[model samples]
Target: MTRVLALLLLLLALPLAACGNDDGEKETLTVFAAASLTTTFEQLEKQYEDDHPDVDVRLSFAGSSDLVAQITEGAEADVFASADDKNMAKLVEADLAAGDPAEFATNTLVIAVPPGNPAGVKTLADLARDDLQLVLCAPEVPCGNAARTVADGAGLTLEPVSEEQSVTDVLAKVESGEADAGLVYVTDVKGAGDKVEGIELPEAASAVNHYPLVVVEGSDHADLAQEWVDLVLGAEGQQVFADAGFGPPAS
Candidate 1:
């Protein structure tokens, strides 16, 4: 009778263990995105988790080129969203993209200065002043490349004190008063709230960057990845982006 009781106890313990495992198991969907998407994506991440109880949404944000490098080096990522087509093309050229990338938003450059505009910056031409310390993204970065395009179109040359790898870093320099001004996206300046003042650049219209989204070629959660893509392309996601100051996707 003691042996029979032991067998029943073991069977009961097995079922409990199985139940525990089921409760703890979750599917993870990792998304690698541009640094500029941080705020908007974080909001979406929360919504996605609330709606999909069984799936965990993880986000990694960085410069588009850096994210591409990570993906190419075999970092496990389900999706990729770039701030520009140039960086997105890198993944396509490597054949690391699962399908044709879809344009999700557009962004244009703006001059970000400290509150009160102490430097009295008013236009892209003001960034070229020798006395002002300007910060800008590196040439390889989308923001930096766009800055160059805008500067060229305006017939001016920019001499930034530092070239950052990401637009956020450039914005940081301006916000901290470490630099008199910086070139960043319109969305970034808007998102900065009162921390920085935005000066519109007419030249910016010429270098508008179209943001793109795609699923990584070898993603284990391809269906989940596509779902995330669909969410971003859907009306809800666009509204979130619009609220954050992102422009509509290029036509």
Candidate 2:
């Protein structure tokens, strides 16, 4: 009859309406992170997605300095994770961060060489050699700042052939044999695996780098943003970072 047909149409419409409401219920969390954090954060993304099926996570990784610049320019991000304190301070200065940020992990500078060491470079002090070509991050970047600390600690002055915007670029130059030596984060070398070989430097003790994570202002999803921060500061997150060669944050 006509009444039976009307009931069937209403039942179909009810499911469609429920689906529309579910779309609005989705909480998307966006995080702007440092380039060195790429490998570790990938693991974090997977873990978080598995834990919160309804929440979606989007990540953008670059030089911490660049991320800060973008956030200051009013980019829409729910979280900001910096490779160092300097960039995190910038976010605070702009009032872009919600509150006092927390340090999640730490890293140190290392000398990265090509698989064959074509230039025969060695030692932190050897970086001052006139014949060696060096690629380093720009001084404004986190890796560059940490490199400066190691160089200063060793009383060695390095004249680099090129300054890259990100640590990944520095590692790429070394991996491709474009540069004889590169100063990059320890985590970068670990992530690169067979592409590059890393040499530990003792002076890095004086310049240990800290990674900080925070929720940015104007985020429509505050709870999810803070939850991501908690995840980063938690056991699984720390384990992933450590596996990538980063250390515990300084006390």
Candidate 3:
């Protein structure tokens, strides 16, 4: 009787030990992404997690330049996605990126205004009005560069009240009525829906920014990082981006 009880206890403990091992050994893949990709990437994160139960997909979103700075400063991440080629090249040139960054999407700049258009901001030139408060992304940021291209192309010199570090920060100012107008990506205006209204800028065509994605060097989960990259380049990812108002990537 004693031997039988001992054997039963050992058998029960085996599966419990296995459960502990499985639970303790799960993998995590961290992806640093452009701020504009927040919503769509969140959707992709959920989908990837559902498909790969053993791996946790974590995301950190910020301005592309800022994200690159973080990585170059020794931040550990499995993947990097930039809102423009300039920032991606910084990583590639520094040997911090693992592979050729693939162009995933393109975006055009637009003028975002709070609900009701209180400032009556109708065109890019209107942003130059002395009384109208304007916010823009800092020149180092991708969106800011695009905004500058459009402004220069249209021969409109804009005097902004503030220059934010990220495009989302500019959008936030417009949405909260802190600024009368802001220059942001069309996708951001769409993402904000009724909170803000977008005024199309024709010169925006001349300053479209191409977004890129790549795996990071020295990542412990390079294979998983590549898988995430593939997923973003695949049909489902394209559809999600398209639905979010992102344009097709330029060749």
Candidate 4:
């Protein structure tokens, strides 16, 4: 009967759709990382893919806070690499990170400006000016915390025009000329190339940010997750990160 045939076709279509979805899954390893890791991670992703043809590395880069929140909500990430120890420790506290995390690298904060320094900003104190539109990472994030420490050490109060969720966002504002000056990691300046210029500030010498990476606990793919972490911490991974301008890890 035609009616029976139609019902059978519909049921067949349902399994086909489900099959497609399952095929799409394809052994993915989800990595939650800080926005600043974009460039280096992309390179590592490619290298990793070439090495493991069957496994796909899926990355979601954002403010470490946001990523941590997602993981806490059970987003099912296999790995986490934060810009600072705070976020990594938060994962450890939540029993989200596997094993002991290690400090991978260090980065110094700098005052990033448009390529030409059109605002004529020259010093960290210049960020205090009411006329120069400045962007800074929110204090909840690692860069922001470093910014604050630098500001306090210099006895300066910076009222940024915008408190960005991530260092990359702050750099973006400067790159787009939306902001006259912004505080960002030295690695960001290196990554931005000519899009932005770095003006090293003495206050920046005050606080150093250390990055840490870890595999999450309860990962179904713990071995794969740790391989990714090992790549980031091992000589090859460390070389990639260091070449990108991150400092030697805390010994």
What's the lDDT for residue 126 in model 1?
Answer: 83
Instruction: Output the number of the lDDT-best candidate.
Output: 3
Q: Which residue pairs collide, candidate 3? A: none
Query: What TM-score fits each model?
Result: 0.93, 0.92, 0.95, 0.89
Q: In candidate 1, how many clashes are counted? A: 0
Candidate of highest TM-score: 3
Sorted on lDDT, best first, the list reads 3, 1, 2, 4
- Which ten residues in a row are the worst by lDDT in model 3? 147-156
Q: Write the per-residue lDDT of candidate 3 for residues 170-226, one digit (tens) a residue.
A: 999998999999999999999999999999988899999999999999999999999
Model 3 stretches astray by more than 4 angstroms? 1-19
Task: For residues 1-251, write the lDDT of model 1, one tens digit per residue.
Answer: 99999999999899899988877888999999999999999999988888887899999998899899989988999999999999999999999999999999999888899999998988777888989999999998899999999998888999999999899999999999999999999889999999999988888899999999999998999998998999999998999999999999985
Candidate 2: give the clashing pairs: none
**TM-score, model 2 to reference:** 0.92
Instruction: State the lDDT of candidate 4 residue by residue for 146-210, as single tens digits.
Output: 99999999889989888999998999899999999999999999998999999987767679988
lDDT of 4: 0.89
